[model samples]
Target: MTATTLHADLLGRQDPQMADVLAGEARRQAGTLQLIAAENFTSPAVLAALGSALVNKYAEGYPGSRYHGGCEYADLAERIATERACALFAAEHANVQPHSGSAAVLAAYAALLRPGDTVLAMGLPYGGHLTHGSPANFSGRWFDFVGYGVDAETGLIDYDEVQQLARAHRPKAVVCGSIAYPRHPEYSAFREIADEVGAYLIADAAHPIGLVAGGAAPSPLPYADVVCATTHKVLRGPRGGMLLCGAELAERIDRAVFPFSQGGAQMNSIAAKAVAFGEAATPAFGSYAHKVVANARTLAGALADQGFAITTGGTDTHLITADPAPLGVDGRAARQRLAAAGMVLDTCALPYGDQRGVRLGTAAVTTQGMGEDEMHRIAVLFGRALREEPSRTRTEVTELALQFPPYGQ
Candidate 1:
């Protein structure tokens, strides 16, 4: 059936309060499986908090101490957020004010090093985020960053090479993380290299923070001088970023996050973050994390079986990267067509190659109650979409999606 037909049927009965708009959006999200590695749908509770009365206040400073009046309630919310964040990540201190992961990263960099100071990090197009050291970003223009990459053969980071670069360059800080990497990063190896070079190590665990909280993934907090992440993806919260660090660096990190990078904190977002933290601290979240990783593994295996190259051979987290060019579909085109059929994923360049891969993650879908069985169906849909003729795979994928439908439908 056509989208208009589907739209009319699905949206015709929505509540009068949000009848016209709400049903159409629900149709979009319910029809599609969101696979964007960096994206996820917020829970209703989180959405409620985001649109709550907390947004009306202007809490321009930390808890208790504020630059504005009438902040008593705001103070309580911020304190709850801060305490919950520390507990969730097992950090001595947590700053939940940064508007985004990029902002948190920039604040960390600014707090750690000065302009023109040399730092070591993963190369862009090799899993590292743009804020890490992309020339187009402020991090690159403000600091001199030397990058290290993975072994060309094994398709994994070469720590020895990183050490060599560190020894030769003697940078002030070493950033370890990725946006598209599938394998687990060697934080110990990165820490060793940093110690040898007398450099600080920062882990950007934005993608795996939930898994880490759930005990399914390694905690970078134990080894990192500072860790940065977003509360939405994986963490399953409202849209915002946070910084976790040792007590010794708490003051600097906090200052950088506030007047240095942003103004008043979004108290509502903080309240939602507290809720998400509470959720992540439960055993149920641990189960969800386990399933998220398993689903990714299943999807990876299926894609590899279809002759697509799965980066790092497979995934250790909830994300999978595939080279779609071999199947005669570039990353961009595949993503667009998949969107048309009700699947949402991002086209991303591989670690060392051009834009030959499509990156997808299972966090959002798993949160929506999908499991390995659903993963197999999704993978088969992906394979069909990329492996067969477009006209042939289109209807099949739509039908497969209908089987899964969507959560909350």
Candidate 2:
């Protein structure tokens, strides 16, 4: 039979081998502690939305107009997704068509910039994303992206230097937010600098939107001309992206996302985004967001106690970056050992350094109902997995994971 005639469970029935690999991933997720900074386990509701029949349709234009027929229901789903997004962020307009964060970033660039326009963004090794301005990425190749790094001593953005670059280069857009920076962004300062240079401030709050929505971090909506986010990280949404902007830029942004950027929107992911946005607006999600940062501090303190060097001395958010020099372990090796012990996180590069550190977050653990005490214990497990015996740590981690099953018992 052709794919169209197959039932919804096509993979499980006809592609059992690939389905087993997927099941193995799910098992690994349930059995291990996920500390990856950018990853989150979306709710079963979001998963259901992803698997819904919405995936079978294609919508090429905005809700009311479409390039194809049979998009009535698709339009409603996209409208619901866009409305929820605007409500969640209190923005006047939202475009939820971009497929990934990088796509969103690219769309934003296409909306506001011509080729060869100068853009100022955080450096990649200094917690910025590849899309931000890594020389190897399209953002760098297409436009002149002058990166501003963190202060050498404090591991924080140098506002003075940013202003200097703004004065010197007068970039068309100034980007804020980073993939791994633990400190809350100085959005107001960024706004002031952008204003002085007549630059559009684009805040890439991909990693911290949930915290911002929960009031744990400063909101960039008031300061940013265009805000781009992945919706998957802290917001716990499906894998997609959105642009929150003023009504004045909404049509331009829509055009950029539709004709200039990606085609045929992912209706299913947009439906999943609506569901996750509903979950995020709850009081329970607010408490969970606060606890995520609290757990991070506890974990960082515990690691400090174990003599591991936290890059910024601590964290004010869900994640912390730590150098492994003190542990006498390579960051990659540390990650492998921790994964073996059923504690999973990835290694990352610190500012002005090689890939010599590991980055971990408490979002997933806190979402799974783990608390400060668990954070401390997890830190100890990190030390044991790296500095001591792996078998003992693996057993301990398994026991602890049993207490807080990710979704349920």
Candidate 3:
């Protein structure tokens, strides 16, 4: 049976409209260039696991000591996910129960800090996530949050400044990671600063967990006190979160994620996460991760040659954050134009800057088996569209996208 037909058989009888929407999204993913740094296309095995019957179970507690019965299968899935997650990142322990990266961060905070403890993290405009220290988020409203930003001319993290802040504030936690920055974090340096100030170091590797697993980026498990990530980003798993730490803090993290922060876990997502971790452990995934970084650098260089100002001058990761002003377009306008041309990405806001920026990534394209050549062509199409030629760029984008259809569809 066809995909649509199978999907219809599953849901069309009860909810034809919802089935149509699902089919529409499937078509969109098959056609568009999904460049969101935090997005990726999962493998078919992962898709099957996500849609599995594991979702029917409700296990409110961890394996072997659940609050409900018939949890044997659920426990098995969670255990497998946890074991694979730990192995993939070389973490001593892994908790695959948190519903999202944000939730995992919250659980870590709950496990380690009180209601009004101090936290030092990069601010939202400075590439940090809302869960890190945005005043609009719970992490901000509950804790006393101090923000640190990158240097102006160099556009690099001011390690000296961070140390100064840590020395002054003596924060309960120091978070290292960013959502829009085009650079890899220095986890060891952050750990040093944390030690100096007696602060717990939380590394939010939500965006590059796959790269870490595949050896394209440094793993934070060896340095950070706690590491949390979303499975759906570069990991190509279901939409869920995983937290990792040393054996000493495993129980604390588990308790925080279970009875304290969230209740029953999403078993389907956990099963899918196990499948993803298994995939990431392979040599082929490692090569794919490296190619993602290479493609990003190539795309950034091509955009720079086409008159776009790349953030931090370049990228060493999957991200290519740039100010679209050089293309005579604002960040929002550039994002809209690109979307109109069938290319998808986000408009970024830089640290302590009013000007808008555009953030591009190569993870999704890499999943489609694309390489540096495709990145160069994507950059060309971006320039063409941003230069007020969406029609021509749209045609080119559609044609090029067909050459590397997502998920091999």
* Model 3 TM-score, 2 decimals: 0.97
How much is the lDDT of residue 371 in candidate 3?
89
lDDT assessment of candidate 1? 0.83
What stretches of model 1 exceed 4 Å from their correct place?
A: 1-22, 389-407
Which 10 consecutive residues of model 1 have the lowest summed lDDT?
Answer: 1-10
TM-score against truth, every candidate: 0.92, 0.95, 0.97
Cα lDDT computed for each candidate against the true fold? 0.83, 0.86, 0.88
Candidate 2 segments exceeding 4 Å error? 1-12
For residue 116, give model 2's deviation from the true position in Å. 0.6
lDDT by residue (tens digit), candidate 2, 1-409: 2111222245788888776676666667767898998888788788879989999998888888999999999999888888888888899999988999889989899999998999999987788899887779889889999889998888888999999999999999999989889998899999999999999999998888888777678889999999999888878889989899999998889899989988899899999999998898889889988988899999999999887889889999898999877888878888888888999898887787766689999888887899998988998888888887787788888888767766675
In candidate 1 the C-alpha lDDT for residue 106 amounts to: 87
Model 3 Cα RMSD, 1 decimal: 1.5
- Give the C-alpha miss distance for residue 6 in model 2, angstroms: 19
lDDT for each residue of candidate 1 in 254-370, tens digit (9 for 90 to 100) = 999888989999898898998888888899989988888999999899888776788889999988988877777788888876776567888777766766678999987887788
Which pairs of residues clash in candidate 3, taking residues 3 or more apart in a chain or in different chains?
A: none
**TM-score leader:** 3
Compare the candidates by lDDT and give the number of the best one.
3
